[model samples]
Structure formats: structure tokens, C-alpha cells
Target: MALTAFVCGCTGNDRSQPQAVVILGAASTKDLLSDIAEAASNSLDRPVEIEISTGPSHALAQQILSGAPADLYVSANRQWAEAVVDADLAEPAVDWLSNALVVVVPADPTVAVDRLEDLASESVKRVAIAGENVPAGIYAQQALSYYQLWEPLSASGKIIRGHDVRSTLAYAERGEVDAAIVYATDARLTDGVRVIARLDPASHSPIVYSLVRLHGESPAADAVYQFFVGDEARHIAERYGFQAFSVSQDEE
Candidate 1:
């Protein structure tokens, strides 16, 4: 997917100086982070302009490694988050959110894929999934492999790769593909698609949305990061179908 950026809380009047906090988030968290940014801007005392850029988790991580300006990094998986931490670009990442994978088909009842195994059937022609480098695709592949369906599906040339989870879901939403594997949260975003099956959590690695506080000393950035881990943020995430990870649980 194209790297997209948005600036929130900006004013029409040219400000001589404004505190800005930059956030790099995974594509799946795009809407969620946007909501959080608005809320954070409202709750903060000062004029804080929040900038958000989103794409596939791996791509975002590479940007961070390449000196992209980011005060906070929210990854869809631990691997990329830890890569940043390992590179000393940020502090150790904290698992902040979680999501589940699901098989979705067009809302049209005629396009049905009721089970994981059904993906291999001729009836389900094209299946859309993110590239393997993306977290959503990685999780989908793991789940499919656990059920012994990856090889068969790959060999049949039925798998279509999307740049990110949102794009993957779009393929099913637009009826360009018979089915798609995406996050439950993404599936909820559109009425054009219906979830046929949720991949079992045990079938793949834990879907942890890890957060990193990039090395920076801006109070605005600190405030934004704190707000993200606060109670209100957790509520916002839950509304988006994301399970908030308790900091205490991580400590334990």
C-alpha cells in the first residue's frame, strides 16, 4: 500500500511554532490511530499537532530504521517492533493491542466459504491476502499452514497478494476475490463482506500490536504516548475491535 500521512489538529492560521508528535502505525491501525489522535489532541492542554503515517508494518519499520521522523511507532506484530528496538531506534516495545484473523467473503450469500478447508475447493476461485512480509499475511499463512492448506492454496495459484490488510479486505469487499483473510477489526469496517470463519488463535503466533516510544524528548510526544496507553484509549481501541493489552499483564 502507498504510505499515507495525515496531519491532525492543524489550524488554518499559520502558526509560528506548534508542538508536533509524529506517529508511524501499521495500516490495520490507521482508523484506530486517527481516532486516538483526535482524542489526544482534544485532551491535551497545549496545541499539539499530531501527524500519522501508516502502511504495512514491515514497511513502516524499514522507514523508521532509515531515519524517518517518528516519535511513536505502533507495529502490527512484535517482530518489526523488536527490530526497531534492536536497532536502538526506540525503546523496548510494549504489546499494546491484539487482533484476530478471519476468512471473509462478499456479503452475497452465493459466495460462500464456510470453513478453512473450503478455501481449497474450486468454488472459491481467488483468495486475497496481504504480502507475506505484512503481519496480517504472516498470521494468515501461519493459520493456513497449521490447517495444512497453504501449500495446496499456493500450488493452485488462487492466492492474490495485497499490499496490506486493508487492501486485502478491499479485494473481497469489491468482489474482486472470492474470499479474503483479514483482521476481524477490518472485516467489521465494511458491510460488503461477511465473515465466514475466525482463525483459531492457537493456530498462529500471538497477534500483538506492539508500541514503541522512539527516542525523543518532546513533551508532546510523551503526552501522546501516555494517552495511547491510558484508559480512554483502551476504550477507543475496543470499539474498533482491538483488545487492549494491559501494561500490568505485560509486566507480570
Candidate 2:
């Protein structure tokens, strides 16, 4: 993504501030930002506006580099963040948060799936997962491949592919897919969804969030950044099943 600074504070008396915060959000983090944006009108003490375009992380990254007017960049993985920083579109990178991978079953369980590995059981006829390109899907693939479940599970013609994490979640929530792979956050949001297992962080690729400030930093932009890394934002994310980023012993 090309480098561009974001507006820092409330633009004076102007009743409407036309702006957009571009997020390479993994289907899970979008809601947290939306809630904060809704309160912007009052909390920002000025006219506030936001727009989001979502897809696979690669797609979002491409959009940003193609001169997409993104005020800030938030990504589901550090890889995308590093891409932007490498391109000089954003400042030095910082990992902001994390989420855990989980297996989900239908809201009304006719087919019972219990463990992360249970997804491969012959009794489970169909399972849904995000495309390999999506982070959630990538994590799922890694975990199953570790357990050597991918080939056996796919051989049964039971693995259905969703375009993104949320889609796979929808499959489980609606009972369209007997089981699905998704982020814990997604499972928490969908009312009919039930979580069967959360992958131990050590069991698969790490789930990390990377946030960067667009060069034209504004008060609103900074506020968004500050809040995301702060306790209030962490709580908002937790309510929806997101595991807040924790400092590792290495950092301490």
C-alpha cells in the first residue's frame, strides 16, 4: 500500500468528515471496529464516517497497494502488515492482538463432533472450512495436517470450502455444513453456532493481529489505534470471542 497520513483530530465545526479506515480484517475483527465507529459521532466530537471492504487477506493487501485510500491498516496476520511496511505504505509494524482457532458444530447438533480431531471422523459426513488463502482456513489446514487429518478427511468428499472464515461459520450455524472451522470470535457471534474445540496456540500457526498508523495520523486515527491496544477495546473484542494479544515472555 502506498504511504499516506491519516487525519489526526476532529476536523473543526465541519458537520461531516468524509473518511475511510481500510482494514485487511480477517472476517472476525470487523465488528469490533464497527461498534467503535458507530460511537464516533459523539465520542469523536465531530462528524465521523468510515467504510470497509473485506475479502481474503491477499485481496485486501492488493486493494491497498492499488492506490486504495486507506487511512489505517489492520490485518488478520502479521504477513500482510509486513507487506505494507515493506512497501512503505505504513510505519514500523506492531502486533496488536490475537485470536484462537476453533471447531464449530451445527446450532442443533444432529451430527456430534467433539474434538478438533473429531472433525475427521467417518461419522461426520461433511465439514466446512475457509479457503486455504484465508487465515482461519490456513490455520485449520495446518492443524489438521499436523494431526494428519486433511487427506483422510478430504478423501471422503466431505470437506466443503468457504470463501472466508465467516462463510464457513455460516455453514455450521445454519446446519448447512455438519461441522466448520472458524475463529473463536466468529463462533461467539453467530447465535446458532456451538464451539467444540479451541486449537492450542502451540498446535497450529499463531493467530496474530498487526496494526499500523497511516502517515497522515489524525486524532481519530490515533484514537482508533490507542483504543484497539487498550483495555476497553480488548473487552469489546473479548465479548465477541477474540483473545486479546498478550505480551510473550520473550518481550518481557
Candidate 3:
């Protein structure tokens, strides 16, 4: 009877353990995290408390490597997750989503900023972009450079800095910036923002999101890891304006 009671107690304790997941994420993933968390909670048979910190990819990576307790990381770019691997903090990075750069204006869409030249006009004075250290900001900078629009745009004194991609989008959505550059994923999050143009995906290095486990691993963490690349999570990703992971992306 003692042995039977002890075994039952252990089983109950195991069943009651909560699945704690911490995501040191980029701002771009904010739109779909709730849906992914819901599916993950169902799979783990425990409530999934996903605490996410949003900032530039580099800053988030440093936070994780510095020993912040994190179950996983979803970065706007693969490089930051790869940083975790270099620090021996996690496994090889996995690309969970593919994204493109986009130019956003106010939801009213009166600017008619349809081309690169349109952006250089004197009327286009202030533009909000992610800070240089941020992934989304870097992409925006690179695209501007490649198209030879950077200098003229910069000379307009309209380049404003957002802490991250989401902040940049917020600037445009709130009528704070005449123009802003953000990921296609960020623009999809709200009806309050409208896209002025869809940037060529090849305009810069591929805009990809990678997932990595932070701290040690566990079944809960693994489920969160898998959820980002699975059909359930992909559905959430699509709804949030990200391209679903191609089967080939899983191998990448």
C-alpha cells in the first residue's frame, strides 16, 4: 500500500507541472505568438506561459547568452540564433518563417508612395526605420542602399529610429512617421497600417526567422520548438503575415 501511494503521488506531481516557455523574441513575431502558445499548451497538457521580450535581435541574443532563463528564442534573423549556437547556449538554429521587406505608410494611403523615386520627394520628410542594430532595420537599410535611395532618403532628415520592427510599424500606424520600413509580418498585424510597397524579397539577404532553445532542453521546450515549424504554428504564422515554412526550410 505504501509503494502504491508513493507511485500515485509522483504521477500526480508530474501531471501538475506547468510548462514554462520563455521566448527572447524579435518584435516581428508578436502577431502570432498567442495562437502558437495556445496550440502548444494543448500539446503539452499543461498551461504554456510564454514570456516574450522584444527588441533588436542582437540585444535579445545577448540577454539569453548572459544567462537569462529562456526556454526558446525566435529571432527576426537567423544570425542571432546562430549566436546562441556559437555561445554553446543552444542547438543549431532552425528557420521557422520566411519574410519580406515592406514599405508602410499611414492607413489612409494618400501618399501614393508607389516607387523608390516617390520616397525621395521633398514631401517625404520623416521615415521610421528599425535601429541599425536591429534585423528589420538592417534589412531596410540594405534595401535602401541597394536601390541607391539611402543617401537621398537620409538627406531628407526623415529617418527615425524605432527600437525594433514593431515600434517602426507603430510609428506609421499612429501617424507618427510619414513612412516606415518593416517586415511584411509586422504590417500584417493590424488594419491600422497599410503597405505602400512590397519590397523585392531578394533586395537583401533572405529575411528568415530562426528558433533555438535557450537554457537546457525539456519536453515542453521541445514542443515549443516543434510548434513553430509545424502545421499548427504555420497556420498562425500565415495569419500574422509571415510565409509558412517550406518543408525545405526545416532542413535549412
Best by TM-score: 1
Q: State the lDDT at 193 in candidate 3.
A: 82
**Per-residue alpha-carbon lDDT of model 3 for 73-160, expressed as tens digits?**
8888888889888998887777778889888888875466666567888777788999988899888999988888898888778789
User: Could you give me the TM-score of model 1 versus the true structure?
Assistant: 0.93
- Tens digit per residue, CA lDDT, model 2, 1-252: 212222223455765655455444545666766664554433555444555445666567677778776656667888877787788887766776778888889879887787777777768888898887777788888877777888898888988999877778888888898888888777778779888887777768788877666566566566555555566666766777667775333321
TM-score of every candidate relative to the true structure? 0.93, 0.82, 0.86
lDDT values, one for every candidate: 0.88, 0.70, 0.74
Q: Any idea what lDDT model 3 has? A: 0.74
Candidate 1 residue runs with Cα over 4 Å from true position: 1-16, 248-252
Candidate 3's TM-score: 0.86
Clashing pairs in 1: none
**Per-structure clash totals for the candidates:** 0, 8, 1
Per-residue lDDT of 41-71 in model 1, one digit per residue for the tens?
7787656888888899999999889998889
Candidate 3: pairs in clash: 127-158
Query: What does the lDDT read for residue 126 in candidate 2?
Result: 87
How many pairs of residues in model 1 come into backbone collision? 0
Q: Which regions in candidate 3 have their CA more than 4 angstroms from the true location? A: 1-15, 109-112, 246-252
